[model samples]
Target: MDRTVVSVLFCFVSYVFQLASTEKNVYNFNGGWETDESKMLARPGICNIDVVDVSKQTFSQKHFEDYYAYVKPVIIKGSTDNTKFRKLCEKTALLERYGDKIVRLSSANTHSYSKRDVELKKYVNEIMKPQTLDTLGNETYYWFGDNDYVEFADLFDQYKAPPYKLPNMHGVYSFGLAAAGTGVPFHFHGPGFGEVIFGRKRWFLYPPEKQPSFNPNKTTLHWLMEEYDNLHQLDKPLECTINEGEIIYFPDRWWHGTLNIDTSVFISTFLG
Candidate 1:
């Protein structure tokens, strides 16, 4: 083979490789998923939780213990735009890397929560399609639950856990991918921290004092989705919108619910 020909072939291969790499990271909003704005729920016209910028303000341990550790809810604004989790969550990245992987799709009704197996690609494609106000959480909402999401570890590792995690609080951390208006009903759970990696999420929080009002008769995830409106009858609740790079910490025993206002990806860690 001629030296010149060999060099030309090498250069061509490099160019092709570079193009493929760039294509993988691209998120084409215009051509892909389109969130239905009208279907999105309006934010509660109330304020309760303290929103703070952790980057510019000092977030001390005492502050955590006093207000957030296991007592109240708080939102910490931090940059997640360049985090590994955000990179891997790109539509192209997920489709190219883990589309074929099989996972559980969790959907709930007034009776109980149920799960069905599906290819990740199929689930993503379905959620990306247009959503309706009626089907948002009742019929179309889905959750990606995995005890070992090794495929996304590359991105998850980028955000290290704080030095002061609750003792013995180790369990599966779930990643949620949903369309606008998709949400869960009012419910209370253990302490946990959730962050928005891609889009906006509205959180409706009710302190322990208001728990009785939101606790439905069925007491199941499906029931909550069906009867979530009952919560509106209650007085003002602590509400906040968590955007890309922002995280919300919920204390134990606090009743809360969430609604995605756009095509979104979220990561959450629960403390047992």
Candidate 2:
């Protein structure tokens, strides 16, 4: 082959690669899975346990030790001073501050977490999007859980942690960003307090030992679509919507799930 011909082919290949690398995935959700019954239930508003708001109370050491640590959950309103943290999480700040940073996103399909790494700026532009019925919580529905805490340490430092400290326990910080209309399946971990910086997050929770009927392989939306409306009144999970500045203190080992009711930014302090 002539030198000129080889050079042209090389240039074409480089241009193609650059285009592919720079392109982001658009979240064009698939819809049309709603049935009359499903729409009526509207994400299984039935069988829900009431989440009590305790935002006004300042807990003493005894209060946390006796009740919130082991036996029950509580929703604390105005629980955090995150004005600065919320400002950093604004779409533009994140895009500029961490545009080149890699973020790990979990697949909402199954119980075990499967992660995919994406750039912060790319995610806001591409993957983070509104949910639709059919593809709710599926691979395409980008739910940005598992924050890179260390990477955002400065931002996390700006946010306040709940003051109540448990004996032998220390707090670990985590933060996440997600669009409205999606969630994960029921799962549990060490007790922690989760707060919404902005937007609304609806949570469904169950006690630790109860182990409510759920499929590990399915997404939360899958359950809402197929079983939420049909569930007996007695089986409905305890539910609440934590709006801006609201916090939910989840007891250790308690099973819980979340659905973003609005484009949301949130942080959690897990105890160890």
Candidate 3:
């Protein structure tokens, strides 16, 4: 190849590298790329949520009080790791330890879904198989509301809840398991703390003030599993993904839902 051509190619490659580096550092902090602020920042005719890091051992009662009382949703990062919890909740461990235990598994399909009591082993077996149109045809395994704490005592004890104390609220912590492509539909309930122990989940939250924008006909449990893409036309939702080891706290009555990006295990406690 000609020397001139070779030199030109090398210059082009270096220019590309420099451009990439510049883009990465646009809002990077402390050698890490910052989370997308545009979606969470308020602009003309737009509403967004806030993201914060408590990984540096910073927790404030005042901050929690403000968000909780006001019903604002916020993403919290770096509070705890899920290594121990993941190991304990893995398929093999769950089968060997709690396989015989009876728990209720709810199907995610609104049209044909219902809750049924199945042994823990059977539920684990279903999730390990490949997900198919048939597997998710009538319904998919979307685990929630294991109200019996004694049944999951070992698994629950493995999670390390944030050190911050919630004021005068009482609720039960529950375990959730779901395979990739399965998710809970849009709904609202009490205030809660969710810790992801394995895999990641994309969360979409619409504030209570925006509740009227949701379709009244579709709010029922039967129709909620249907995704309403038109919501973005009304308002930009507060979006974030809670990955393994990260914890998220949202106040009561926030319309929130999740999609499992990967097979995941989650622990959540709701406070009213």
Clashing pairs in 3: none
212 Cα displacement, candidate 2 (Å): 1.6
lDDT of 1 by residue, 1-272 (tens): 99999999999999999998776444325124444456545432344679878678877767777767877788877523446656677778867877887767665332255666777798877644434444423455376455246766665666544433665677347777776656666767688888877767788787787753433322222333445556555565677888777788888888777767677787787778
In candidate 1, the residue pairs with backbone N, CA or C atoms under 3 Å apart (3 or more residues apart, or in different chains) clash, namely: 109-222, 110-222, 110-223
lDDT of 2 by residue, 1-272 (tens): 99999999999999998777654111111011111222222332432433444465556668767877787777776545777777777666767788888888887754556778888777778887666655634464463557777787777778888776768989887778776666767889898988887666778888987777877656666676777678798887888777677788888899998776656677888999
Compare the candidates by lDDT and give the number of the best one: 2
> Best-fitting candidate, measured by TM-score?
2
Candidate 1 CA-lDDT value: 0.65
lDDT for each candidate structure = 0.65, 0.70, 0.62
lDDT of 2 at 178: 72
Error of 1 at 251 (Å): 0.6
Q: Candidate 1 at residue 272, lDDT? A: 88
Q: How accurate locally is residue 195 in candidate 3, as Cα lDDT from 0 to 100?
A: 76
Badly placed stretches (over 4 Å) of model 1 are 1-47, 79-82, 109-111, 127-131, 136-138, 162-164, 212-234
